[model samples]
Structure formats: C-alpha cells, structure tokens
Target: MNFLYPGFLFALLAIAIPIVIHLFNFRKFKKVYFSNVQFLKEAKEQNSSRDKLQHLLVLACRILAVMFLVFAFARPYIPLETGADPDKGNLISVYIDNSYSMETVNKEGNLLDEAKRKAKEIANAYQLNDQFQLLTNDFEGKHQRKLNKEAFIQMLEELKISPASRTMQQVVNRLQQEGDSRKNHLVYLLSDFQQNFVGTEKIKSDSSIRYSFISLKANALPNIAVDSVWSLSPVHQPKQAEQLVVQLHNYGAEDAADIPLKLTINQQQKAISNLNVPAGKSVKDTLSFGGLEKGWQKGVLSIKDFPITFDDELNFSFRVNSEMKVLTISGDPTQQFLKSLFAADPYFKLREMAEANINYSTFPEYSLIVLNGLKQPSSGLAQQLKSYVQNGGSLVIFPDLDAGAAVYTPFLTALSLPVVQELKTGKPVSSSIELKDPLFKDVFDQIPANMDLPIVNRYFSYLERNTAGKESILQLPLSQSLFARYPAGAGKIYLSASTLRPEDGNLSRHPVFVPLLFKVAFSSAKEQPMYYTAGKDDLLEQQKTSVSANQSLVLKSTDGTEIIPEIRQTPGKTLLYIADQLKKPGFYDLKRTDSVLAVLAFNDNRRESDMRYARDQNLKDLFAGQQISVHNSEKDALSLNIEAKNSSIELWKLCLILAVVFLAIEILLIRFFNKTKNIQKP
Candidate 1:
C-alpha cells in the first residue's frame, strides 16, 4: 500500500489518544454493594468473568476503529504496477487550445478560460520540480524549450486566443519536436476537441508518450455563421455590377429565419439582404453592387450570430483596374494590323514597340505581351518571356512562315510545350470555336454551330506528344491545333500556328478577332482573392510600380506588428511568401518606404466554426494500442485514471468502510454486555 501524500501518515498518531484513554480511568468501584458473601461471591465471579471478557472485546474494537479511521485519513492506496516508481520525475507537456473556437461560453464561463484553469490544475497535479512544456496554437518560440513548473504556469497564464488552427496530429508533431524526450512524458491536451480540427484518424498510440484529453464542451446552443464568400464575376470591372454570394450555415437544431446580412465596400454600406437558413443546412444569398472606383476596394460582408462572432464578418479586398494594358512587340514595324486591332478599344491601353527596342524590365506590367511576326526568336528574349509568363503574365506567340521549326523548338521545349514540326500552306482552313471556354463565355449572344470560321491560309503543324495541360481553343479543318493554351506556373501561354498578317491568314479581319484579343487581355488582368488563411502558405502578389533592388517590403497588421516576409521581384509584380509568421487574421498592408503598396485581408481558419465535437470513443479508437486516457475538464484533474506501471488505486474508501464496521461492532458488543448484566441481576 502507498499514499499519494505520505505526510498524511502523521494523522495515524491520533489512534494513541483512544489507547491512552482506555488505559487510565479514575472512577472508584463501589465496595459495599454485595453483603451476602458466599452466594454473591459465586454469582459475582461468573458475572466478573463475563464482564472482563466483554471489556477486552470492547477495548479491542475501540483500538481497531481508531486505527481504521487513521488509515482512512492517511489515504492508503495500492499500486496497480509493482515496477511503478514515485521517485522518478516526469516530463509533462500541457497543450492549451487557444483557437477562436475556444471563445465558446458555457456554464463554466469561456471555454478558453476554463482550459487555462485546467491547465494550471494539471501543473499542480505534478511535482513542483518536474520539467514542463506549454504549447498552444501560436507555436511560439518559448514553447520550444522546457521550463520548471513555476515558469510553465506563468506562461500558461499569459496565453490568449489565436487565429491559427492546428490539427491534433500537428500538435503532437510539435510536441515531439520541442518536448523533452529523455524522461517519462505525459501530455495533457485541453481543448473543445472540435472534430474538424482534431483529426482523430491521424493520431497514433505511442508507448513512450502518454496522452490525456481534457475536453471542454458547451451546452448545445444555436450557432449561425457566414460560412464563406464568393462572387459570380471572377474579374472586377470599373462600371460592371459584381454579384457577390455569401453562404450562411446554421449549426443548430432549429431553423434560422430572416437573418439580416449587409455588404459594405470601402466602409460604405452597399447592399443588404435577409436570408433564411434551415437547421443543419447552408443557404447562399446573392448581393449585387456596381460603380466601384479604379483602385483597391475593401469590402466586408457581415451577419449577426450569437456567441460565435469570429466568423461573423468576412472581409474582402480586391483591385479594380480601369483598363487592360497590352504590350505588342513586332518584328516588322510596318505591320499595321497588330496596331489597328487594339487602338480603338477604350478598355485597352495598347503600346506597340519594335522587337529590338522592347524593354524586358517592363514585361510584367502588361496584362498581355504579343510576339507578332517574329521569324526567328532570340535566346535572350526567350529567357525574359519565360520568367514573365510564369509570374502571372499572359503571352501570345505568332510563328513566322519563313522561320523553320528549329528556330522556335528550343524556346518551346524550355516552357514544357510541344515543338512546331513544319509549316503547312494550302487551301484556307477555317477555324472552329470552343464556345464553352471561359474566355468565350458570355462573349457572343449565341454561337452558331456552323458559323463562318476564320480562314488560315498558312499554319504550323505541331508535333504530337503526351503532355498535360495542353488545350486547343481553335481547331483547323482537320482537327489540327491552330491556337492552344498552356498553363505556365501562375500564368498562361497562347500558341498560334499562323501570324495575323493578311498574307498569312484572313484571321486579322475575322469577326472573332476582336473578342478573342479582348479575352486574352482581360484574362491576365484578373485580380487575386483579397483574403488568405493564415498558416496556409498562401502567396501575396502585389503590383510594383518602381522599386530598387535594395528596397524591402514589410507586412504590417492592424495591431502595429510588422513582419519581413520572403520577397521575390518580377518585372511588374512582387511576390511575398507568407510562410507561417502571420498568425492573427486582420487587415494587413504591404508597405515600402512608408507608403501602402497594397492592402491584404486575412481570415481565421474556418474549420473550427463547424462546432462538431469528437466523442470519447473516437479518441479511444485512434489510440487503440496505446496507454491513453480521455477526461472531461469539468471533472477534477486529480482523478485522472492513467494505466501505467505505477497506477495508484486509492484505498481510502475501503479504510472508511472498515472503520465504520469496527465502530459498529464496538456499539453492538456494548448493548449485548449490558443485556447480560440485566439478566444476571439476582
């Protein structure tokens, strides 16, 4: 038998009080009661023997009762495992989930606050000198080192809710990375155990590490959230109406009726709608707004929901460009067809330049770069175009009739594209349009199946190869690829077999020429989504006007915190690598020289908003082969049942029962002895 608190054994000395009392009684015996000596002596002797026997039995019962009571107070417990040692210190790690989901309020108050309290309790349950580690969703630098119990509790007290969300597997992996692995380690995970983020399937039982799950659950109350936001128009135009769609989900038992939603742009209320969301269902509502100024437009979609408010408002940041910039590079300056095609369009800002005078440094600024009538491509120009097309710029290539396949094959191979085999010139081949393509969608009122296709008198026949992401937008009469599109990193490349000159083909004057060219320019000008999820490794792309090589880009949040992210500079674009430094979600600005270059919005991980909890059985199933346990934080932390070699089974309850039994025997003996005295009265 062992005692959790061996110091309580001092209470066993209390038994001596009863023993001292039994040994020293001062009451005098009455001597003149029995006058008749002979008969009284015989009967008194019999009663005296019985009285002595009863007195000894009662004394023994009293001693046993006192001993049992002392043992109960001492809290004796048997060790479940003989090899378990109490002297060895343990390496304890406590993970307090401080995600936004922990903001839920129950009878015990806020779940995060309750988790912090339980974390302190777990720390107190261990010895003061034990090495401890505290982890949270922030995964800060201090979490990488172990601390004493005092420091661990101090760090635990400083924890606050964070926007970052990590799966259970991630938490375990982090513990394994930073925790002390030398000693016996016990990990306590205090969380609401949201099923979407917990990821039970990924948890495996480890013999070296024991886990205790402390789940904090709130009463099932109705929660509604603006689950997500999208738009009908992928490209935001200056004067065009943008139809925004917001999805509202009700994660409750009752239906939500007449939920008011509002849309605000640049801090001005733009549209409002009332939505009805069915129980355990999602409803999408559409709001239309137009006439946004040409610049960065900050938008917000908000809905009122009780208790859970982190996901109440969705922030949107998007750019509205006034015109599409098209840069046309021509080998033959006299080719007026290329210049005339885009000059009259108010939506296009066209700049034509000769091939020799083309500035490679300015390539990324244009939405589309047209390589018009180039007979032979230079290696230097090909290298510049490769980088341009990969960093979200669009390119259109027109092969010259005089240039051989050898001229363009090397450049095409560098971009993972098929090489042009030979030039074919014969009867004019008509073009077949792909109306279902996004570039052609809504372009024509109705597309005729047998419409007069563009005539191609000369075209390059491309070699056939099994390459992915090669799609034909326009096909020749024999199903040969005349114009095809290939995705290059975040951008695209369009390959045309024929030039736009009159002798090459009549395609320059075809009805499809204007819309086709306009689509290519608009496609490259599409803005990236304004918001990004933190810890998700999303790239932030910003347009660069003019920056020196030594200039640095810094991202600053609304709270005045600044971070230097990985910056990559292209011709007209700058890419920032948001690699895990930004944890909180809010409005952040990419700044250079104290000027706001671009504004970005970040959102908290939405997986926790679902409010689905993992059951105890799910954790058990996940840790099936390991010595693990699950516990509710509502219960006392000291009562945690761990199956280890030195698992303690408290015997205080048994001691209390034995103490009662002994006292009861003492009372029953007193009553029986008194009855015998009454019967023996002569």
Candidate 2:
C-alpha cells in the first residue's frame, strides 16, 4: 500500500486530541441528598464501572474516525505492477477501430459510437497533465503527436468509419514507433478483433509496453459478397463479344437462393442473371456482353446484398482499342503470308520493315513484334528485343533455318529460348496438337481421330537444356518441339522452327497458322488489371509515355478532385506511385493535362467481408509471450480496469466509508449508554 499524498499524513496527529480529552476530566459532578446511603453506594459502584467502559469505547471510536479521515485525505492504494512509478507522468496511446465492420450494432448502439465513448472514458481516467495519443485505421500523419486530455476528447468526437483496414500486428508496430521511451507506455486497442484483423502470424511486441485489448460484440448478420470479377479475354476490341467471370461468396450458415446479379458498362445495363450460392462456399458465373465502343469502358458488377452493402458492388475499367498495331521486320520483304493474313481484317494495322531499316525506338508502340527470317541477327537487336520482351511486350521468332548455328545461337540464348543444335533434311509429320493448352482451349469445337497436322520437309531441332517454362503447342513425330511457347519475365516468346520459304516447310500455309497468330497477337495487349485494391496496391504500371519537363500526370475522379502521383521511369514502362492517395471505391481517370491516358478503378479490400471475430483465447495465443490483457466491452469496466493496471487499486473511498461508520458508533455509545444508566438508578 502507498499514499498518493503522503504529506497529509501529518494531520494524523489530530487523533491525540481525543486521547487528551479523555485523560483530562473537564466535566463537573452534581451531588444530591439520598436516603439509604449503602444502597446508593452499591448502585454508584456498578454505574461507575459502566461509565468507565462507555468513556473508553467513545475514545476508541473517536481515535479510529480521525485516523481513517486522515487516511482518506492521503489517498492510499495497492500497487498492481512493479514497474513505472505512479508519481511520474504517463504516456497513453489509444487505438480506436473505425473500419466498416464497426458499423455493426449491438444492444448499446453502434460499435463505432461505443468505441469512441470508451476512448473518451480511457482518456478521462488518466491525469490532466498526462500526454495521450489517438490512433485509428487511417493512420494520418496528424495522429502521430500526443495531445492533452481536452484535445484527445475533441479528436475522439471527430472520428468516423473509414474504408481502411489494418491487422493487429500492423497497429502494434505503429504504436511502437510513436511511443516515448522516457515515460511508461500504456497501449489500448478497442476493436471487434475479427479473425482477419488478427492475422495468422504471431504478434511481436515489446515487453516494456503494456497492451490491453477490448473486444466489442455485435448481432450476427448474414452476408453474401461479390468476391471478385475478372475478364476471360485478355484484349478487348471495339464491337467484339466479351466474357467476364464473377465470383460470389456466402458467409452465412444458410444458403442463399436466386440472388440477382447485374452488370452495367458506361451506366448502361449490359447483362443480368440470378445465382444460388452455397453456405460458407464460393460460386463463379460467367456473364457475356458485347457492343462496346472504342474508348475507355467503366464497368460495374453489382448484386443486391442487404444490411452489409460495402462489398456488394465492384468497379472495374478497361479500354477497347479500334485497331491493334503489328510490326514485322523480315530479311525477305517478298514474303506475303503475314501481310495477306492481316490485310483480310482492317482491325489489324500491319507495318513491314526490312531487317536493315528497323527502328528500335518505336518498338514499344506495337503490341506484337515478328522477326521473320532474320538471316544474321545483330547483337544490338537481340539485346533490344530481349529488354522489350521482358517489359511485357510479346514477340514471335521464325528463324532462318539455313543460317549457321553461330548466327542464331546468341539471339536465341539472349531471349531464353532453346538453341538450334542441328539442321535435318527429313520429312517429319506433326503428330498432335495440345488442344488442352490455354492458347487453343476454346478454338476447336470438335476433334477428329486423325487430324491433318502440318508436314515439315526440312527443319531445325533445338537443344533444350532447361524445360521449366516450355509448353509445346505443336509437337513433331518423336516428341520434338516444332512450335513452342516460353515465358520470359513478364512476357511470352513463341518460337517456330521453320521459315516462310517454300523449301523450309508448309506451316506458313497450314490452316492452323491464322488462329495461332491471332491468339498470340491478342494475348500481347499487356492487359492491365481490371481493378486494384485501394490500400493494398500502391504501384500502377502503364506503357511508357512521353512527358515533358513542364508536364505531369494527374489522377482525377468524377468529383473534379485531382492528385499528381509520383512518376518513375523504367526501360519500357512508367510506374505511378499513388500511395494511399486512393481511398474511395470508384473509377479515376489518369490524364496528361486534358487528355485521358487511362482509366483506373479501385475497390475496398474484401477481407472485412468475413464478419467473423477472433476469440479471446485466439488473441492471447497471438501475443503469447507479451504482457497483454484482453477485456470484453460488454463485460468489463474498461476505465477501471485500465486504471488498476496502469497505476493501482484505490482505497480512499473505502477509508472514507469506514470513518463515517465509526463516528455513528461513537454517537450511539455516548447518548444511549447514558440514558440506560439513568433509568437503572431511578
């Protein structure tokens, strides 16, 4: 036990005043004439003994009353913890969870409102001069500094539900960064403590910092969320058919039936359907739509979910190009197979160039580049093409089979393709095609037992040292790769063994040539993601763009709000770092001055959709070795518990109550005892 104000103990000397009064007899006795002196003497003896006992009891009560009153002024309490003297000032950090899940309601009302109230109570429990820090999911820069009691309460009132969500370890790391080492640290986290919030990993904490977890409860709600949406086609063309896969999740115990799903593009209804989702499981459905114009298309996939609607709607954006550019650099300009194939469709803009007159600077302008029969490929061209392919540009290589091994060795090895080992002059027929590959998964409607595969009169066999990422699209009789695809960094390489010359092979004239090249060209569009999570994705990648010293890119929303993101230039791409700049779930246009460069969509993180909270034991297990305590908001007195853990268990009120009871006892002994003695004498 210790006293908060030990100097008040000097007032305990007042107890001696009662002792002095008892010792000094200041009352005078009145004598009366009485008959029967002997009987009066016996009565006087018994009454004297009773009078002494009453006087002694009165003195004892007076002493105890004075002592307890002094103790109450001193303010004694039992210390709970040994570290950190209560005499010194304290630094308190309180984290209030204002995420979307906190919008849940309980018997006491909204959880966010209750959390704010609890935060204010915690602030009031501390001393006036003590410094306090208020933290929330937003993690704003202004919340890093400490504030006084008045300012803390004012800030608490200004908090609102935010789209940002953070895990328990992340919150603790932030608090640890803002703690003052000089003062004792007390950290309080008030949240619903969802299982997702307390991630699977164990929490690392400082032993010196005391942590308190106050778990809030709410009424259970059943929810079905549109988990995700993705496009089946990599490239989008104007007035072409498209398909999108939408995944829905049921987070309740009971299954949901006939949930209406809707798709809208550019504010017009494109497709609609009904779905049935099983309990605690996910279901995927495909929506087919077409007739989109040539520009940026803003798409919204929505479902009608009640009570919890934040994760019901998903926003996405994509571009439908009017034409696809194809660049071809061939050693023989007379080859007209590729030219005739693209000329049949105006959607493909083909530009032909000789190997000696190729412009390396305009490589990024084309989606696909074809190197047709480059007899003696230069090392500089190989290096440039390698960089272009690694930065998400697609390439097709039709090697000049007559060229020596030394000429094509460096080029093939630079692009991580198999090198040409030997040239064979035998007629080998292509045995089979990989119908199950993603390239030809939907291209064939039916397959015959004996398919008329391509025939090769003369070809070059490759020396494949590593087959990690090699996928044989067209195979020869002896399991040899005639046409294969290899994944290099972020792009793909399609390698063919024969050239377009009639003496080489008839693959250029085969029926499978058109669709194979079309699929490869379509897959080269560098499809940016349909959407990005707001707080999770910080970097946005785009094809390289030219920006002058005076020009900058701006991201503008529909409300006219704009932000200039940090721009970083790499070899074949431009990276825009919009760290935490996007908070709302909608479409934002990335523009250079007045012209829109691209449209980007952002959505809230769906981890909060689970709506399942972590148990107290789970939280304890996460921070097993740390000095942590868990309290339920519905059961514990948060302020008193915090106070008791921070400082001590107070005894001043108990001391005051005992003082009043002693004073009442002293009054009874003085008045009632004297009346009884007088009655016995009569």
Best by lDDT: 2
Residue 300's lDDT within candidate 1 is: 84
**Tens digits of lDDT, candidate 1, 1-682:** 7665677677767777767766786668887566567767677777877877777788888878877777787778776432334445577888988888888889999998898888877778776767888889888888878899889888877888888888888888888777554566778898888888767474753566777888898777678887788877756779889898889889878999998999999889999999999999999988999988888888888888887788888887887777878898888888887678788777678898887787889887788999888766787888888888877789998877677788888867776678888889888888887778888877889767678878888888888685588888888866688788998876899999888888878888887888887788778874767688876646877764466788878889879989888877764467788677887777788788799878888877778788889998888887777767788777877666644312455678888898899889989998876455422344
Consecutive 10-residue window with the lowest summed lDDT within model 1: 80-89
Candidate 2 per-residue lDDT, tens place, 1-682, comes to 8888899999999999999999998999898777778777877998898989999999999999999999999989777663665666688899998888998889989999999888877777777889999999998998998999999999998999888888888899999999998888888899998889998899998877888888889889888998999888767888889999999999877899999999999999999999999999999999999999999999999999888899999999999999999999999888898899888878889999899898999987888999999988998998889988887788999988878678898889887788888887875555468888887867889998888877787777899999998999998767688889998766788998777777777788888888889888888886678898887788999877789999999999998878789999876678999887777778899999889999999898898888899999998899988777888887544445644356567799999999999999999998898565432344
Candidate 2 lDDT at 472 equals 94
State which candidate has the highest TM-score. Answer: 2
Looking at model 2, report the run of 10 residues with the lowest lDDT sum: 636-645
> What TM-score should be assigned to candidate 2?
0.88
TM-score of 1: 0.79
Error of 2 at 136 (Å): 2.2
**Model 2, which residues run further than 4 Å from truth?**
7-66, 81-84, 124-127, 414-418, 427-436, 446-452, 455-457, 464-472, 475-480, 625-629, 636-647, 663-682
Residue clash pairs of candidate 1: none
